[model samples]
Target: MGKWSNQINGRGNWSFTKYIYDNLYNFQWINRENNEIEDNLILTKSISLERVEQYIYFKDIFKGEYFSKLLEIPEALEELKIHMPEGYKTKEDIIDVINSRALNPNLKALDMSLPTHLNFVLISLNLPPHEGEVNDPMEYIVDALEKKYTKEENN
Candidate 1:
């Protein structure tokens, strides 16, 4: 069995998104035997706002149900970065700070799937302070994809 396959099979502890996030941290390269391998080292380099800008440009390509909410997070984070009082420096730190906002454990019983979580966040964000009514982010994403992919089919 190959090293990658071994790791792949051994990934029972990691969630699928977590696994992808972890692998993305590595600098992958071909080894002497033409095997694809990653340098088994974690980078200490912090993901800065500058890096986040570059990340946002390609973020749309990573569309899952959570894509729009994930995209909005970076924007929310960037704003928080500027407004943050002294101490926070890295994006991870800012994420922690954002997460610190007071909230109640008002979670209700329902399907706890990834797609469901994505829809929850989308609905919450689109909720209004006496203005626009909430729209389903998932539907927006589907419509956008249909327009992009189906346009060529019609042509």
Candidate 2:
């Protein structure tokens, strides 16, 4: 999760993505000896995003219907990042600052089971704006992780 964040420069920074990753999947490395492992052991199994998308399932479907939505967020952020050279303030700001229609088609993950504040935010970020409610929700999906975990790097 943190190991494969989208931001290359921030490829490994301490952020909130881990909470979402842990909630979605109960995963740990297979260690045969001392049982200690490293973060490099965490990986996506492919180099291509499309190929990765094909494998983003637990059994029969993408982990969350909205997981795909979370996946699309980075591209949207890239657009927003350019428009607001400083930074994007909230999910609605991404729309308002861009002068997009105040309303937007929302995407939600209906069947996935993970429940956590981080999980909620990942989905909320894609939904049509409920302004004056939740604010920036991209901290979870964006590259907010570190190559290596540290007490100081806790998310």
Q: State the C-alpha lDDT per candidate.
A: 0.39, 0.35
lDDT of 1 by residue, 1-155 (tens): 11242233432221111135444333223343424232333332363212111111112232233433553577655765686658874665545544442311212122123244554544555532222332443455455457656886998
Residues 6-99 of candidate 2: C-alpha lDDT, one tens digit per residue: 3224223222233354333222332334332212222233422221111121222222343335436877556545646365645554544333
> Which stretches in model 1 have alpha-carbon errors above 4 Å?
1-77, 80-86, 89-112, 127-155
Candidate 1, run of 10 with poorest lDDT: 49-58
Task: Report clash pairs, candidate 1.
Answer: none
**Superposed model 2: Cα runs more than 4 Å off:** 1-72, 85-87, 100-155
Q: Native-vs-model 1 lDDT? A: 0.39
State how far residue 103 of model 2 sits from its true place (Å): 16
